[model samples]
Target: MPSGSLRGQVALVTGAGRGIGREIAIGLAAEGMGVGLVGRTHETLTDTLKECARHGSRGVAVTADVTRHGSVREAVRAVERDLGPVDLLVNNAGQVDRAEVPLWETDPNHWWQVIETNLRGPYNLLRCVLPGMVERGRGRVVNLNSGFALRPDGNYTAYATSKGALLQLSDNIADSLAGHHVVVLDISPGAVATDMTAGMPMFQDMKTWGSIPYMVAVTVDAARGRFDALHGRFIHAGRDNLEELVRRAEEIREADARTLRLRPYGPQDPMG
Candidate 1:
């Protein structure tokens, strides 16, 4: 909320090796927050850590498979040892299906692999880091979600389903964390140009791309407590008018907006 407000804070970011994750880690560092760069590749993580250090922020490059609970725990332990208790958790590690094929034509093993990485990755990290955050009575989690999670996609079924499940997971946790002084927000960086997206055939024809810097700003705002009021809700960095959302947080809550829900047919409907 104020200048230097984030100084001395600790942030643990999964998939901090590259893309949006690397941007987020550096942004946090620029705000003077010590950052833990977690990813499977040590070289990339080290590169990110070096940049974070340029901001005079403490940083650690820890290599670990996010889908494994034990590996995640050890990684978290290492970060805490180097950077202090984690004040923020950025769940950015995820992947999409290699081919944008229909479910009937998709390889079952590959589908499961997508689920394991995209869904289970964040689950492992959340479980490992949340207890400490709750104990400390302060923390924030920013889940890198996707627009695909909100609608049915004819292709990339695995990616869509896993992201949808992740959205549900975040929503459920937000309710459980109601009084814990911790907040979790899901954000979609719509079709940003990254190594991952570049490999995807669908994005090649796309002209406009999401703003990487805007996504970084959103994370910074979350860490600064700007989006605490919108916990468990989905925020789109590429399209959302965040200031309007914050100004009308009360309206959003009253109307149950920005969340996954069953639409009512009419006022007389029992589900409404």
Candidate 2:
């Protein structure tokens, strides 16, 4: 049965061809939302679209890359034309560092490519999608972020740096959308066993993996306003009880927890 509240609404999910993005698209569809599946591969996107249709949901697949602003704008237009104004935007398309190599040891082209795909991609989507949301006085954005953003890891410099920037971008956008009634969430799917993760050197030796269903559930809840209180806050799907977090949203927000920040060495330090 389709869940209530989301029926008839629309969602545009990037990287919907596979992995978490694929699952998220289907999850929203099951909840009765029209979905736009955006990805570089038409065949894979069409596969996801068909799955969404099985749930009796409307969907469209666009074979487009996220790194190009004009391409993203056109993609958004096509999705809106098919599924109505986007009520939710999921920036799920991203890549990780190719190998466990230090910054200088990494290939420069690959490093910049990662930067473009991870950081620039989300920025492009937001630029194209936010105006309508702001005008409508309602909408939500979910940026697939990571704990990597909160800490440093020399090996995955590009990936970590991009996510950290994205984290701040979400925080700033969330604050800007206060009066507009739009909320942005920075969430980490948390080591899900996707191809992206499979290629990651860190997850290769791990036996345990994050739950795709749990991650999907969190996304649906976010769309339905369950986690609106945690807007601009980082939500890790594999850890932290969501119910408990929601219950203490005010405390978390006031404490300014779960965001990237520079720690000062002393009270007199400017960063503090």
* TM-score of every candidate: 0.96, 0.97
What's the true lDDT of residue 39 in model 2?
94
How does model 2 fare in lDDT?
0.92
Worst 10-residue lDDT window for candidate 2 reads: 1-10
Q: Which candidate wins on lDDT?
A: 2
RMSD of 2: 1.1
lDDT per residue, candidate 1, 1-272, as tens digits?
22556998999999999999999999999999999999999999999999998888889999999999999999999999988999999999988888878899989998899999999999999999999988888899999999999999978998999999999998888877868888999999888999989988899898988889888888998999999889889998888888999999889878878888888899999998
Name the runs in model 2 displaced over 4 angstroms. 1-4
lDDT of 2 by residue, 1-272 (tens): 45646998999999999999999999999999999999999999999999999999999999888999989999999999988999999999999889999998999999999999999999999999999999999999999999898889999999999999999988877788978999999989888899988898788798988899889988999999998998888988788888899999999999998777778899999879
Candidate 1: where is the Cα deviation over 4 Å? 1-3, 265-272
lDDT scores of the candidates, listed in order: 0.91, 0.92
